[model samples]
Target: MALSHSLIQLLISLRRQKFIGAGEPIRMLEFGEQNWFYDVVPAELLILIDEFQDVPAERRQALKAELQQILDTKPPTEPFDICKVFYKLVFNYEDYTAVDLHGTPQALSLDLNEPLGLPPHSWDVVTNIGTTEHVFNQYQAFKSLHELTKPGGVIMHSLPNQGCFDHGFFNYHPTFFYDLAEANRYEIVALVYADCSKHPHQLKQLGSQADYVRLAVSHQLSAYSGIFCVYRTPTDAQAFKVPRQGYYDNRLPPELQQAWQNLAR
Candidate 1:
């Protein structure tokens, strides 16, 4: 069995125990990590895994072989949707059929790399939570989102503030907010900080004044930058512009977007 499968099983078990809250769930499959959004919210969640380039050559080869074996052997379940092309896949596209009757139709899981290629107006909303900072090509990613969204489509994003510990290969970049909005021509709607101190348990784990100061400084310098953004596409008909800094502009609209731009500036 591949280590990724073991990890998924472990996560599923933990989820059943209520250990993992409602968050983005990803499964490492034969191709790449598949996002299981149908089990959660449909179109609202986009699955993005970090550190693809850093995998050691040998391990990557082993992973590909393991994935192929799993794919050839495992039968598709009723709820699963498999994509053999991209390294990432989607499971359970049809899970929402029953949900539409509940009056809470869930959104579908979208792959950032391989878009659905639907018209811009097809989707009502697009969100990127804690994802932009990891991209090596942030500008291109945001531009792609701009083109994908309809005019007035809402976008929400959560990016790390400067002082936080490095969770991925790339650390937080302060200019992400400005660049995203400017490039995509998105209007900023709302910007809110995800205060780390609110979670005292996490604070305790990161004990010590210096450590706390580092966290505070990083966030303060960059606006306590956790989960900042509530953006909306412009009403204007211009093509979506990619920002120079990060991938997408997280800003909302004129009234709200202006406020965040002013504050961040």
Candidate 2:
């Protein structure tokens, strides 16, 4: 449940990209454990290895110190609260729900598989830093995210895509969001193959879903790549209706009309 430095980089970039407005308080639903930012994202990156990774102390510490020095040359613009970004903070976790935020990062719990039990269209931004891969009911989890998002809001997810094994229930393929975006008529801000290259972690810009599919076979990389997606819900939208796969949606096929008719009836 710890927030990763990569997640911090993305959000800061998102804000700079103007996807998120300056000083706009965002409501966050944490699917699991969440600590404040500074504690996790430290000025030094290696300090975070202990919270999640199993690396040698000397190796990580040394790597991060060098990495940290490089990062300090160009720190991200810090507008929103650290709770809204990175760093394992030093605040009392129990006070998370002391009251609803009027202009701050509000953390709440969300069960990806069940009804969010929250106000519909309530959150300005919903982030699944590292939880969706663990939830078995993927549809419900995504649906709950959509339901909780205010129209015109954005939902971002940092999901494992390749090179990582046995890390969770599933490693997402880009098609999931590509198809979902098409079905729900979403406006994609950015969807790309992201890598953890410090000093300059990069994200490949995705043009279209079809093009992405055609190129996937040719562009396999060695490191663990994450799928970073930003989807903007349309204003005046209602509940999300999951769309069927286009291959299956193609004319229902004359060969399957009888089955389709029976199901329709």
Candidate 3:
């Protein structure tokens, strides 16, 4: 799994809109040491560089030089570490850590299939971008993501939603997140369905499961569609709460059920 340009754009947009990482620096924890699909740095990242308004002018210039060095030194065939190179550089935030079983330069050796055994509520931001689906123990992986996030912090995920056939252990559906958030009392920050077939991705923001179904019917969406989500962990978030399937549990709100019914008409 790799970090794509659209993910970076999502992060930049969140900062600009003050969704998170605004007043002060943030401590970010990533599931894996992820690389970019792009051979070279995308030009649009200059906008992300500009948003580092909290940093001093000198430090900001230094960050730019560091980015330039990466471009000059790194071969295009070997993509740069998105977490270390892009996220850290753009935010100028040093409190970033990545955990991977392989222990790459940007990651600490840790297994996601078991308990993380790390300090709880230590990270202001926890990300599982295209990582957890590959973990056979989905429960443990998700629990780790939940446990790592600090109170009032956010946990971001990008998982297969519609049709990533044989891409990973499983493909997710919108109800999975909807019910997960409901069970954990996580505040749903944003939910988006993305068509990742090409660059400059197409996205549809979703508020409910019906929205996902509607988006599927409304367009010639690709089989590689993805669910992009950000959910805020409340200060009082308890232990990781497993949820029953929303459909069988009759958990969907009445309005949403009506919406789904309307779609069938």
Candidate 4:
């Protein structure tokens, strides 16, 4: 939910590489609205009760027609019905799940203070998509995501990094995931920063962790941005442990140690 068009495209490109595998069903749990994803992802294997009303009330027919038009015009080699995908599951806050075939809203909550009460290993994919910062208990919310994901499942997060006050309770850094990967033994597939202040058309390509120096200086300079990262849970189920802060992970090497220590010049 709350995905940028660029973010959707990123997922598509990554999926094409078989990063998460395509043929099998993808059980995705979104922490918020995923309206844009419906337009791009292959709907044949996607089942989620789309609770967000992306199109305006009066424009639904037009949007439907547009979807149909795209499907009809798509090249023969392309897979999936471009216009026919629908939302399948609805998440509710009251310790229950309710779904509307008509794609209407259901009771939902992302509160970290309360238990989600969902079964463990229930999802093949868990996406935070800018929700964790709003949850008062960041670690607890993340733990829920971890529990909800099946072994070998993927967890994705996109969070604010700079120049967005009043946006959420916390803004994250790339090192957070670097440290997280080491602590939890998660395999990191992608980690990058996107500048959000610009228009989608104007936004530059995302910078990977390899661009750490530029990212660090720009973020330090108050550039508007976010961090997007994907992590794969182990093939076997593991306990969800709160990750230690980066500098304290105990697996720290010299460069990382220097990064954290202020030099006594």
Best by TM-score: 3
The models' CA-based lDDT, in order, is 0.40, 0.58, 0.76, 0.58
Off by over 4 Å in 1: 1-118, 163-166, 171-174, 200-225, 244-265
Estimate the overall C-alpha local distance difference test score of candidate 4. Answer: 0.58
Give the top-scoring candidate (lDDT): 3
Per-residue lDDT tens digits of candidate 1, residues 1-265? Answer: 0112222333334334433222233221111122332323322112211123333456445545544554556544312322221122222111111101111223233444454354554333444544545555654556555665557665545456544566543444335555566666776655444444342212112222233334444554332334345567777646755455422344344543443344433
lDDT of 2 at 264: 21
Error of 4 at 25 (Å): 1.6
Off by over 4 Å in 4: 37-66, 69-104, 201-214, 217-222, 262-265
**Per-residue alpha-carbon lDDT of candidate 3 for residues 73-166, written as tens digits (9 for 90 to 100):** 7654335433455676544355878887754665788889999789999988888888888799989999889988888888999888767777
Model 1 Cα displacement at 177 (Å)? 1.4
Where is the poorest 10-residue window by lDDT in model 4? 87-96
TM-score of each: 0.41, 0.64, 0.87, 0.69
Candidate 2 lDDT, 156-249, residue by residue in tens: 7778877567888988766678778777778888886676543244667777654444444345443577788889888866767786755466
lDDT of 2 at 11: 60
The Cα RMSD in angstroms, rounded to one decimal, for candidate 3 relative to the true structure is: 3.0
Give the per-residue Cα lDDT of candidate 3 at 224.
Answer: 74
